[model samples]
Target: MLFIDPENTPDFKRSLFNAIVAPRPIGWISTMGPEGSVNLAPFSHFNLVSTAPPVVIFSCNAPADRHEKDSITNVRATGEFVTNLVTWELREPMNISSLDAPYGIDEFELAGLDKAPSRKVRPPRVACSPASMECKLLRIVQIEPQRPGDTVSNVVFGLVVGIHLDPAFVDPDGRFDVARTMPLTRLGGNQYASVGPLVDLARPSPRHD
Candidate 1:
């Protein structure tokens, strides 16, 4: 295997590395403005940052002219957002919300998605999503963008306040069964994959070496 240090390679090295880390989870974030405008978008640069406090992170890239996107703006205004898990069945509608729509346009209507009222937040949850996380904004930390004069970027960190999961996806003991959930993942540009197969490794028991 060839080892590459990003700084020593072409400018696209970092981007290539990220892409090679295939099948990253998507964060379908939904947020509402004070005027009740709703925004929805899928972010690939997302992951669970902490489990102890139930913290998650999703990167929000500013527009080309260098300003916060509607989703980021809405979250900043309301200080709350819902993260919906994209499933293979909902991929089509999920793609619709990924468009660059004008502000105040309801993505739910544009994407023809059903909105279920959130129990703890203003932004509603996608009815078709396998799972949804209601979160309160903890911080929006700015980061350097890939290109000079490109959009400003920041990873929004949130504390999960409530979790909504479909009963069918949960096991008898209340564990989320990935096999049944059928969650969708981002695989670079214009590509996606589903969760498949299972591999279990038992932890080592205490023994004298």
Candidate 2:
């Protein structure tokens, strides 16, 4: 077994960090700047943190230059953003939006995608997304820089204020058909995977004394 310390490994991020995490959900976040500019970006460091009052978080790691990403910058400025689910059908457009464009560039137009107005947020949802969550800013936490010139992680937490689900993906039992959505997930080194056959496992019965 190889024992490696990240702090001592200069190339750990590129060599092992993301690979070890395996497949992670992509948070296709959309936000509107204070001046009304729109921004869209994909973050692998995103996940649902709470179920009650639904809270989600996305972390943005700043470059060595310490430049804040547009997604976090816009969320801080407007206090509103949307998380659009990226399915296999919408993967290309999602990847296009991930381009490191200029601050004021509209990713929707850049990707040739239409935006649907969100009910509880200023930022719009991707028209073609299978689902979306309109969120209100809860807080922003800045992780301390690990070392001089090291990148900082800005974590943004939000409360899901509203959810939009495509009726076509809803089951007769009122469940959102996640398996049918075929959501895309990020792997290491520019790789991605799509949701496949799911395994159902039931919890074990409680023991009786």
Candidate 3:
């Protein structure tokens, strides 16, 4: 096996580290800008951070030149945002919204996607999404860079104040089915993957003896 140290590797090898992490969930975060402009962006470094209060986190990188991404700026200003789950059907629009559009540009309109009112957040949800989580900002933590010249990243944590699910996608068991949801996920690089075959893994019996 070949060994590589991330700190000393070339930029291409560093990117491979992200790809080797396998498929990650895409965070289709939406927020309302200071002037009420709708903003949307996709982040691969996102996941559910806690379940007790249904908290989610998405990390935004501040480039060497730019102040911050639109999604990060909007969320900080409004203290509320929406997480729209990207599905196979909405993949194209999701990709379009990821464009580095200028500030105050409405990605929703840019992508030709309809918006749905969110119950607990200032930002709206993607109308075609199978599910959405309305979140209130909990905190924004600046992650210390590992290296001297590393780019800055802010990890925004939010509590899920509400959730919206498309009734059509609900199963008889009251559970959301992955197959029906057709959720899209980020693979390394520019590749994406959709829900595939399911495998059930049951828990082992308790050792009471």
Candidate 4:
């Protein structure tokens, strides 16, 4: 086995970290700019952070120019956003929305996707998404730049205010059918993946003294 240190590695070599982490869920986030222009983007560095109050986080890495991504900018300005689930069927549109378009450009229009009204947020959700979460900004945590010119990362935490679920994907037992939904996920580089065969495991029961 080869050993490597991230801090000592070259800029290009550091990208291997993403691949080592394996597949990650895509956060199909949508936000409205101050002037109401919609911005849609996909972030692989996203996941649920809590369940009691329902919190999620997505990290936005600064572009090469060290500028904040439009998704983060809009979230900062409006304090609201929506996270739409990316399914196998929506993969193309989800990838299209990742384009680094100029400010004020509506990615929904660019991707030719219809917008569904969010119940608790100004930003809209993808009309065809099997599920979506309307969220209000909880806070933003910034990852300090490691080197002088290194880009920073902004982790946006949100409190889930509303959730929408398509009836077709929800099981009669009241659980979201993960296999049926076929959520899209990101792999290394330009690769993507979809849900596959699942393994079921039961947690060990508590031990008695």
- Candidate No. with top lDDT: 4
Residues 76-178, model 2: lDDT tens digits: 9889999999998888888999998878999999999999999978999999998999999999999988865467789999999999999999999989998
List clashing residue pairs in candidate 1. Answer: none
Q: Worst ten-residue run, lDDT, model 2?
A: 8-17
Worst 10 residues of 3 by lDDT: 9-18
Q: Give the TM-score of candidate 3.
A: 0.94
Relative to the unseen true structure, what is the C-alpha lDDT of residue 79 in candidate 3, on a scale of 0 to 100?
Answer: 97
Model 1: weakest 10-residue lDDT segment is 6-15
As for candidate 4, its clashing pairs are: none
Q: Write the per-residue lDDT of candidate 4 for residues 1-209, one digit (tens) a residue.
A: 98876566565465586797868999999999989899999999999999998999999678975379989999999999999999999999998999989999999999999999987789999999999999999999999888644678999999999999999988889999978888999888989899777899999999999
Of the two candidates 2 and 4, the one with more favorable lDDT, higher being better, is 4
TM-score of decoy 1: 0.90
Error of 4 at 201 (Å): 0.7
Candidate 1 Cα outliers beyond 4 Å, as residue runs: 1-15, 145-150
Q: Model-by-model lDDT, in order?
A: 0.86, 0.90, 0.87, 0.91
Question: How displaced is residue 208 in candidate 3, in Å?
Answer: 3.8
Give TM-scores for every candidate, taking all chains together and pairing residue i with residue i: 0.90, 0.95, 0.94, 0.95
Model 4: lDDT equals 0.91
Q: Write the per-residue lDDT of candidate 1 for residues 1-209, one digit (tens) a residue.
A: 97776545555433564579888999999999999888888888889999999999998667765388888888888999999998888899889998888888888998999999898899999998879999999999998765543457888999999999989888889999866778889886688889777889999899988
Report the lDDT of model 3 for residue 184: 89
